[model samples]
Target: MAAAHRARHWSFGGVVLVVTAALVAAVLISFSGSVAPRADAAVAAQTWSDEFDGVAGHAPDGAKWTLETGGSGFGNHELQYYTNSTSNAALDGQGHLVITARKNTDAGLGCWYGQCQYTSARLNTARTFTQAYGRFEARIKIPRGQGIWPAFWMLGNDLGTVGWPNSGEIDIMENIGREPNTVHGTVHGPGYSGAGGLGAAYSLPGGRAFADDFHVFAIDWSPNSIVWSVDGTTYKTLTPADTGGKKWVFDHPFFIILNLAVGGDWPGSPDGSTAFPQTMTVDYVRASSSGSAPVARPIRGIGGMCVDVAGASSADRTPIQLHNCTGNAAQQWTVGNDGTVRAFGKCLDVAGGSTADGAIVQLYTCNGTNAQKWTYTAAHDFTNVGANKCLDAKGNSSADGTRLQTWRCTGAAGQKWTLG
Candidate 1:
């Protein structure tokens, strides 16, 4: 759960927390980098776990988890709005917590895109539990699709106060749909996170997709050490030295998080080949202190607010305006590989594909045209490729809902931008 440089894809993950740099508390915890006690040295006690034995169609135990509801993109430019509704997250009596992602353009949840095109759920143990040290594991059957992203991870409980990266994060498992045979485990801290996160991949042998059955994904932790394993097969381990001297921020308490995202930068947007109503069936999740348990980042624009999609809509020509940064999905923008700035699976476009000066800017379907192409230069100006104009907030106003337009580049404050 590291929300660092670039849009996190939930892998360091292609995932994230929505806190901002300006609000970060600068509180760093320096714990001794000594190794945690070895397994033979002490018998770890079982502290907490979820069997998903609740009545079918019911929500998971509220006392043991907190349902995070939002479509803020979670720093990943993800497409789905995580909701508290049982329709998105519920238990099956047979023993499983099913987090489902559905095609729901009518959900009306404000997403990074205008109307949320999809709906899912994200759950965490942030309020119910926090462990400093031990083991965390889960048995899961992941769903498959072009843009589905499923993960089991941990984040520092000090996230709110310290912000991300500094809060530390340990991803036990993260599987993007494209890599059906592989899953990743990673660590994100002060110097390493997002696409730069340090981690490794573990794959099922020979053309096997993990969705075939339930598999145990887990991490054994002790002090500076964290080991990742699949089905009890250890594949990777990490420590302070592995960070190239970056501060080891994982020494404190953390909480668990589980989520299924629909689309984002790393996983790309869902396409025709993708089927809707995908489900991540979690058989069980357990935690015990060997110890204890485990992360937002945002994009800021003119007026110290954020560049946001009006109405969180993805419909063609929706105004891309300035708004009080809510850190929601609407504000999560990604500088795509194709030179397009995207949000909610759509591109920042010059209205009507016009390249003329003073052209209105809006959200539109990515159509590989000059109107959608842009260059974010070293000077922080977003130069529209076709018109050679810069994106400027109207009237140099910082007011929420100020519309944006493309104007002749004049080195104006209204034309400057800072991407996360």
Candidate 2:
């Protein structure tokens, strides 16, 4: 799973409904002080009841996170020397995790290649707090000036077994000082990996940068989908179909990591206009499960385009065609807890599994296969279980003449299908 293989299949629909805006605004307002939720009048809630409780305002107390140090360069032309000791990384008492990069006069004892001048910390939950599906968020205020790139992200816990993009990378929040107001959320995996990986940038309203205040950046991950949100409002989604015909790398467990880099190819270096030793103040970090519940029902296709099965055919490559209606395994679908939808034991797959329109739909083995993963968008559209291709008719043909196929989504109602 190379990072470039995670490129998203782009599509634009009507403006997202503003329904979640009010709720997000309220959460931001309530986040001013400690993020404690009100208790019932009869019973007092615990102090850490909020999502980020316990993990904020200091170096994580529990053994859930490990701080990585040492002068090992992380491939980036960074100025700071990474140290494993807590001396350089600690709670500033003002409620900020300070990871300072200072120019040193003598780089003798702490030197890596030779005279190393700076030292900072990289924290990770690689040994603790690995989770599958849930909502993850962090509220942080960043330091200003150039050459600063801060990130809050997750890596598949199976990194040792799978490696790199194959293990998957979920970047929940990433920002460079130059692009202050614009934050990125990305997913990197094999096939769609690299600079154009599956990702999107969310800009603050009125061109506001996130450095001045604490903002909530989050991601809602389910078996079949990954939704990126800012302040709790979903702005982007990535599905299996978006990555061609690969496996859905998100079903397994992943651990979190947070770091502030001095310079990188993406963020570049600080010029004369840049400032140094910038800090990213994290108010808190939190993770939660989707809660114990039964899997949701699969959406059924309607509008008289149901496939009609005449009789039992050979299991190998048996093709079923769309007709009036016929309740059969070839037509009926069963969505599994792992976010895969199967019919006749074959996974539902997009034609050529391509993001382009008119791609036919087919069935294949599940196998944690990415093409079998589908995402239901708020617009009631079914995107490729791997990529973002929409389940569409060959054209906008409502008549029987239109062939059922997958196409690059235009976000039309005809392309919308209900997952019953």
Model 2 lDDT, residue 93, Cα: 66
Q: Give the per-residue lDDT digits (tens) of candidate 2, residues 1-420.
A: 122222221101100111111111101100121111112111211111112333333554545456665554464445556565555556766545665554445446453346665556667765545666666777878655576777888777666555666778898887777777788888878765566578788889998878888888887665556767888555666666566677669877777777776655566666777655566767777775532211223334446465322243313234434554444434454443345454533456664456655666665433455666765556656667566677775555555434456667787756766543
lDDT by residue (1-420, candidate 1, tens digit) is: 222223453322122333211122212222222212222122345777999997899999988877878777877788898888999999988999999999876645788678889999888876667776667999999999898999899888777677777888888998888889999888888778876888788999898999889999998665545768898676775655578888988777777889999888778789999998899999999876542111012446677989998997656789989999887767766553346666654678999877677789998766678898887677778888888898999888889899999999989889988765
Query: What TM-score does candidate 2 reach?
Result: 0.59
RMSD of each: 21.1, 14.8
Residue 241, model 2: Cα distance from true site in angstroms: 0.8
User: What's model 2's lDDT at 356?
Assistant: 58
Count the clashes in each prediction.
34, 45
Model 1, residue 78: distance off in Å is: 0.6
TM-score (all chains, Cα) for each model: 0.62, 0.59
lDDT score for candidate 2 against the true structure? 0.57
